[model samples]
Target: MGSIKPAKSLLYLAISMVIGGTLLNVNELAYLAVFPLILLAMGLFVEPPSGIKIERIVEEKTYIPGDEVTIRVKVMIERGMGMVLLRQPLPPEVELVKGNNAWSLFKGPRKLEKELTFSIKVPRRGLYTLPPAELYIEPLLKLGKPGTAFLGNPVTITVLPLIKPPRRVRTTNTRSQIPIPLTSYSLTGPISTDFKEIRDYRPGDPVKFINWKATARRGNVLVNEYEREGKKTVMFYVDARPTMSVGTFQENPLEHAVSLVASLAYYFLRRGYNVGLYIVGRGELMMPSTGNRQLYAMVKKLMEVEVLSSANEDFKDAMRKSERIIIQYTPLIIVVSNLLQANELREAFRLLMKHYKGRVPSIVFDLFPYSMFSGKKVELVRLRKIAIERELKAISHVVHWDIRKTEISAVLAKTIRMVR
Candidate 1:
């Protein structure tokens, strides 16, 4: 206790004064010793104030990366108290955007109830816990020491990934060579296999689709109409190996991959398509579903992604394991990888062919390394560029994308156009 040292010094001083005063017959010294003894006695009997309480309120439990969060801390003292110091340690994933995290309050002779509020900016996506606030209460008597107590309960917050709304990528059938507008699949356009009525035939109408009975009755070229087809299933593969950790946070391959996946998943889910995720990071994570719930789950998983230096997860092995799931859903596969090696791309393509039997449409997003390491390490960047070009040439048969020159949405739009 802070009071122990001062109390002990006073007691020692009192004893020395009394002994010296008795030997030297000095009455002033003896009288002076009485003050020290009385101070020590009073300090030893002082009691710390009880019934102190602390409450904490967090404005929200979830946030996106770079969002500012507000935290309010309230301290209530049932009785008058002395000086108090309060502190709350923040998680390293966030930065103080406004206000202080620690404060010292000098309590007067009155009961105190005060509130402090501060804001922090989330730097990255992840789950973080705010540690409890600590209060150090100094004793009323100067000779007494301060006592420490923990206040407030720990609070958990989930920071979701930063999502950039992606441009719509129109869906196309596996065999269709023409792209159809998404609006065509609604009630206004023709739905596959569900007949609505017969209408006058237009130019380019298929002869096979013409209704002989309707044509004969109307005495004009009439064709059968149908409702639009249902939504398609889409699967996304995010490559999160250590190689993706290259570059700074602003341009890191992994960061870009997370943004891309979040944006794509959000776009497709909103369009009523079944979306699934297969993340190849420190471990294999899969979320095979659709709708807004699935989108949230996929983004949460991506938010917690970390690059493991010792991880050697084989791309072929991850793809092989995903084949069974992919076949069951029959989803349109989209692979987001850095494509640093030719063999990795070949192996991924091999697995897709094996599972889909060349009947399903697949797209690969090649995150070029040069875009991430711009203006640094000239020789290494050149080598990486050469390797990427070689790999691209080797896998010319598959539909591939270079996303360096455009936003993820534009690249996705281009892929949809090409496939359609």
Candidate 2:
């Protein structure tokens, strides 16, 4: 039912006119009082617009960070309106790009419908909900107070992290790029174009593998053999401790760690390997699996990651808890974290080694948050970072990743190359 209440301003005016008329013994004042009283009486009988409805349509419910999102909101009212306003509050990380998210316009007492369109840019990765559109109606004659109603149902959008390609690092003395080898095993696995060698053609070999140049040189049929990629389980350990919150929220150790985990998960999933995740402080895990579904699931978990100031989840304890899964999967363990204390990491690695029969090949990525300092602090932080990296190397393959100087994928490739 439509909701309408008499305007308090009009009620006070009516009361004042009546009191003045009686005190002054003026008939004109009494007649003048009738105007506001009539308006109040009419307000009691009237109602605000009814049958209001709003529906929100998002162009894509899922988006990558820094991508623009288009939104269309439709408002429909069956009958009765003075001025109708529709507005909705957006998530803090979202910024307007195209049109207004709020709409205000005069409407007559008839069926009213309008479609409002706008665009927004999502800057960060997370699951965000757009609040329901609010509909406010004001009586045309100023006879009744304004009425408010929440219109549309909330819409949720998932902002996924951007996946960037691997970047190469520059060397002081060499111009050649580092070779990235993706090792594969098994006879039936996918083969890389990286030709291993040309051998005499074997029976039942695919004709497409014939190397014409080698055949002409030797005067015999030869086949090119390529590197065969094999499957492996990769478990990612992403530290969520407070120490990772170093630098700005937009560019921090924690942010890079999450993105690094996501990108690596993507890299492995495409290679037919099962990937698992362990959010260190959060204790969230995704059992090892393969395919785009796994990538999506991993990214979904990563999108929810945030640096908590109070979660003091022990690294050693986290490793111990996942000992069973680690043994079962026999995954290449990947740890993404900032250097806490050198001894603390050694303890964590010790617990990890206890579960494996042999040394489990593990890589530890240490993020140097360059954004945390200016000119003077750089040299000092650099020296401290090197010391930490040096200490960490004794326990695991350490990849020193400065946020400004390197890409996550590049450092990851470098680490993987070193492991190989």
Candidate 3:
């Protein structure tokens, strides 16, 4: 059963009873009957309000972390009521003004209406769901509280990922140039282009590569010309270690490194170099591949790769596999990392050098903040950082980049100096 307005109706009924009883005792039965009838009529006649409309408006659909955003809720009552209370429901993560609930009260005659607005700051980056508003109303008697009805469509707001320039960013060692579109043949080993058919030596044939069997048939010496393949396989090794954290919360230096990796991967992939990425961390190994599929794979991996102090030996083994596959082919190896261990650097460079017979060149990128911490503000720390940078530079071809001083582009431009 619906709530009865016992208190309100009883109050008026009591007053009417006093006056009616007094008059009735004086034989005024007509007024006594009329008072009770009026009280009963009001109790039975009060109708509930309806036709309320509620809508929410957000300032923007997409927002990054630390952005000031506003959300406004508009409520309109189409019909009037005795007393109506509107309670707006907000997401739990959002904080309302003064720590109060989002609610509004309206009280007046029939056809009475109003609208209310509530705004709050978005706290973090994620999608938020907005709850509906609750509409409450009551009739003549205030015996109990108001009746409630939830109305309004659910709304959504998407908070995008935070993007900022890195304070200390590292650039890779590989310098890429567009290869000429010539039919590049394999130069090393039993490859198709390296082996030219044996022919009878012509008058101008070089004596070093001439085949005697073919020369006997034609009675002349034949020459062998080796073709050089234009394709260059550039492998990028990213050292995603825990000690390399460069920036504050929400903005990480690793993101800068990932961005650089992504851009370079795209750049190399476009230049027709089979680009591969190896992230030295937990369970993350993106083998060498090509095209948009491979790029997407790399980006997805970078998106989820976490930093660790040390990677599994499986990663190094994977690198060994890559080394073997491209032993006769890969001319350049680019390892991007914040150089920490001298022994690790020595061993990794040693392995690559062994494959190339001291001919293959490797670049190690030491990503760290060397300049900001170098001042007198922290003299000892500066000295230690400089010492490490110099040590790494001395051991291998290292590109030292100060992420705080410049962006990745500027650092990348200066990378040529390291090789020179």
Q: Could you list the CA RMSD of all candidates, in the order they appear?
A: 8.2, 9.6, 9.1
After superposing all C-alphas onto the true structure, candidate 2 shows an RMSD in angstroms of 9.6
> Judged by lDDT, which candidate is best?
2
Query: Higher lDDT: candidate 2 or 3?
Result: 2
Q: Candidate 1's residue-wise lDDT over 33-101, tens digit each?
A: 999988777666655454678887887556887789998989877654467888988987678989999
Clashing pairs in 3: 80-111, 167-403, 167-404, 168-403, 169-403, 201-221, 201-222
TM-scores of the candidates are 0.72, 0.72, 0.54
Q: Give stretches of model 2 more than 4 Å off.
A: 1-47, 165-231, 354-359, 412-420
lDDT of each: 0.70, 0.75, 0.58
Model 3 spans > 4 angstroms off: 1-231, 309-318, 321-331, 370-378, 416-420
Order candidates by TM-score, high to low. Answer: 2, 1, 3
Question: Which is superior by TM-score, 2 or 3?
Answer: 2
Clashes of each: 7, 4, 7
TM-score between candidate 2 and the true structure = 0.72
Per-residue C-alpha lDDT of model 3 across residues 56-75, encoded as one tens digit per residue = 78776556545655666666
User: Candidate 3, after superposition: displacement of residue 223 in Å?
Assistant: 13
- Which pairs in model 1 have colliding backbones? 2-145, 3-145, 190-227, 190-228, 191-226, 191-227, 191-228
